[model samples]
Target: MNIVCIAWGSLLWKPGPLKLASGWHPGGPLLPLEFARDSDDSEELALVLCPGAPLIPTYWAYVDAPDLDAARAMLAAREKIHPGHPEWIGSFPAVDGAAVQPEIAAWLRARGFDAVVWTALPPKIAGTEGRMPSPAEAVDFLAGLEGETREAARYYVRRTPAHIDTRYRRLIEARLGWRPLHEAAVTRMA
Candidate 1:
């Protein structure tokens, strides 16, 4: 089955093997993107589209996969989501035929894709499991992190797609209270 995985956050840039086929294109329906989901691997809370939040033009990348099961397994492994775990990633369904977004569905159908699987955590459900931290709290959370985890978070924020000078990115930066990458470089030079 021809499959495509939807990436809206960290997967956008660091997709591992998910980006092997056809690379990725800027596509998918606009969703309410926010950094509300707490990460089990890192201190920084990751972004997720929640219901009842203000909708924004969120970007998605599509990666081609010939095997649906393999693709799902790879994604699950990368995300560290056990099959039956009920935290966040597990809740996402592997939809077929682009059912999540009508426009994307039409395009995929036209391309002769056999299946489309998208995994995203809706904010409402995320809240039920555990409350997303506030901006101030998130910033405070990042303050205690160091080394590779901190660097990874910084890289993720810099690569994520959003409107120029997006509030989401700004909030993350301001909350992190870290100097911009450029500034840090200049400071090191001085």
Candidate 2:
């Protein structure tokens, strides 16, 4: 069997050891992607696929699976999803390649890949010990960092793709009271 892992953020750049059966292709607007939720694993805000917000650019890659059951298990495990709370995983229809279509959920269900997993962390509802910070709080937190940590945060914002509008890289800069890195880079080059 084959499974598709829809990606729009860090996963596209760093898939780790996860095997891919296909190259990344434009996956149609299936869900909203953003860096809104605070990451329990890191000080930085993490990307989430949520219900609200406009559709954003996304990519998908295929993975070969032994079976549907194993595909679900492997995906959930790979995405670090809790088994008890399956809502963290959103399953949608598989597009033949990069093509976009509506009602993908129904299509996937018909094809027996209904349990295919995509990760989304909704606002609030502590996936960790405490409630994840809101986007505003995350901005404040990032602004308060010092030295290398601050530079690292700025670099992360600088490197991230701009299509991920919800990352609010400019908002982070303005909130931090700094100029945009791209502008600064341009100034340096001149």
Candidate 3:
């Protein structure tokens, strides 16, 4: 099966164990994304799909898996998602005839991919799971981070793909001056 992995954040730059058959390409589906998830252990306000967040362009690459199940397993391993929480790793056509994100599903079909997979971790903040912080709250959370944690948070926001601009990104840039780093700078830092 022709499978692809969708990404909007860390996966674009640091894919870790997720093997891709091709380099990331722009013009992936536009999804509602926001920096609402408080990353586990890192304290970075990681990006995740938010119901009412602004639609932003994401990136995609063909996965090197042989089938949908293998694709999902590879993505889950890359994202550190335990097998118990399969929902955290979203998949299209999860079951035959099952409904998934219609828009993304359509996009996938248009691109001739048999299936797509992405990280689907929920919004989290201040130890409260499923809680989505406002743009101001997200900025405050980043500002509150200190030392290495603060640097990591800054790096995440700045290294995010330039095309994946979102509401919180603008607020973070205006307030905390964490603008997206240019591609050359990002490559040099890598």
Candidate 4:
């Protein structure tokens, strides 16, 4: 009965350490505690729409989707508008089933995404047959807070629009092979 947008991207700000990871929203970034401000926090969800960073962080936005179909359509529209937007991974409609990592991998591959960034994937979990969970299944896949590594934070943020030949990927790849840090942010960090 819940709807979520599962995306991977380099967030505007770094997630830093596991204990330091903060929840984000359109209003501004927020911490998980902020969501717990009320008892029915689970009913609410967020949708991240950032674009073109060296590495796009893989994250999930849990929005209240009373109609899963409608939510999926909305997300599809967003993807078409900005497929390269790091968070454009995909909209996931959570239902009763085990996690499917291969499905996600196939989806990325089909979409030309060579890699998916994540804090880490455990070897096992309940209701899951050791299959990898997409960002949507992460919270359900893991037992506790696992620090999101800088390596894991980075993802394919189309520094600019992309082409069929992957001119964008290659151009950026030439400038900076592959890492989580953004071109500009890297200099700032340096």
Candidate 5:
């Protein structure tokens, strides 16, 4: 089965254990994304798909898996998601022959991929498991981070792919001055 893994954030640069058969290619899909999830330990307001977030560009790569199940397992492991939370790891052509998300399914069919997998983690804010954070709240949360945690959060926001621009990103940049990594680097050198 020809399988592909899609990503918009850390997975693009830090694809720790997800075995990939090819480098990430741009133009994967445009999905609603926002930096709303307060990660478990890092406390970084990580990005996740939010219902009303702006549609942003994503990247995709062929996974080195033999089938859909293997691809899901590989992605789940890489994402550190527990097996019980299978919903966090989305798959196309799920057992019922329907894609997890209709939009993604159309993209998969157009690309000729037998299946696709991606991190489908939902937005969580301030210890609220499914709450989405507003742009101001997201900014305030980052601004409140201290020392190493602040640095880590800044790193995460800046490291996100530049093309994946969203409403929250603009707010973060304006409020926290955490621009994209390349922009920051160029500014530092200037």
Candidate 6:
């Protein structure tokens, strides 16, 4: 069964529960996860579109789930928060983004999103695990923000998610004992 997980608002701090359940990390937001400035290629991936608020009035589905019931159960997790869909899966233009501090802008590049961008590149091939982000990174970042106070939300939404910069690294290191990917140093592209 192929399941897709996504994280939009505050949950973007982690790569969503479904992403965790998928046995991999979602690397980051959609653009950074799938279209690396260094990727130089792109494809139409089955996006797990969470259509609705993180609190209520949400729904979800999968293309390869055994049935709707299973998909519903998967989304109905107390731990995972909101999960729903109406995700737009289609051809997206991808390019090898800068090999530097590039994912943030890349994520912004993929913006105008209706839902959260969790799993962009699902691991359809064998042996390869689903794309996950660095949990260590998230932890470190959160540690940094441990005492910081956030400003008021610009949008009508009260709170919005920020900084998944160093997330999901710990899980990758812990579960697989795999060293984290070496993030290329980067200057913000203007």
Please name the candidate that would achieve the greatest lDDT relative to the true structure: 3
lDDT of 6: 0.26
lDDT of 1 by residue, 1-190 (tens): 5566555666655666554465455554455566666576664557675554455543334445456566666676667665664233321233322225444455556666665555554332223544655666655555666898877766655555544233445766666654334422111010
lDDT of 1 at 48: 72
* Span of 10 residues, lowest total lDDT, candidate 4: 31-40
Task: Provide the lDDT at 130 for model 1.
Answer: 47
Better of 3 and 5 by lDDT: 3
Measured over all alpha carbons after superposition, the RMSD of each candidate to the real structure, in angstroms, is: 6.8, 7.5, 2.8, 18.8, 4.2, 18.3
Give per-model TM-scores: 0.67, 0.66, 0.91, 0.27, 0.91, 0.21
Candidate 6: worst-modelled 10 consecutive residues by lDDT? 35-44
For model 3, the superposed segments whose C-alpha errors exceed 4 Å read 95-99, 184-190
The TM-score measured for candidate 4 stands at: 0.27
| Residue-level lDDT for 21 in candidate 2 | 64
Model 2, which residues run further than 4 Å from truth? 93-116, 124-135, 146-156, 176-190
**Full-model lDDT for every candidate:** 0.53, 0.55, 0.82, 0.29, 0.81, 0.26
Give the per-residue lDDT digits (tens) of candidate 2, residues 77-172: 766667775555555433213222343464455555433445544554235423545667767767776787677666656555555666455577
**Candidate 1 residue pairs in clash (backbone atoms < 3 Å):** 50-123
Alpha-carbon runs more than 4 Å astray in model 4: 9-57, 81-190
What lDDT tens digits, residue by residue, belong to model 4 across residues 1-190? 3333333322223322211112432221211110000001121111232122122233333433346444543544433324333232332222223233444445444544323222111222233422323333333222132344222312323221121112233433454353223343321120
Clash count of each predicted structure: 1, 1, 0, 11, 0, 27
Greater TM-score among 2 and 4 belongs to: 2
lDDT of 3 by residue, 1-190 (tens): 8888888888877888888888888778988898899888855889998887778887788888888888888888988887777888888877433336655888898898888998888998888888988777888999999999999999999988777688888899999999888663222121
Return the candidate ranking by lDDT, descending.
3, 5, 2, 1, 4, 6
What ranges in model 6 sit over 4 Å off?
A: 10-20, 27-68, 77-190
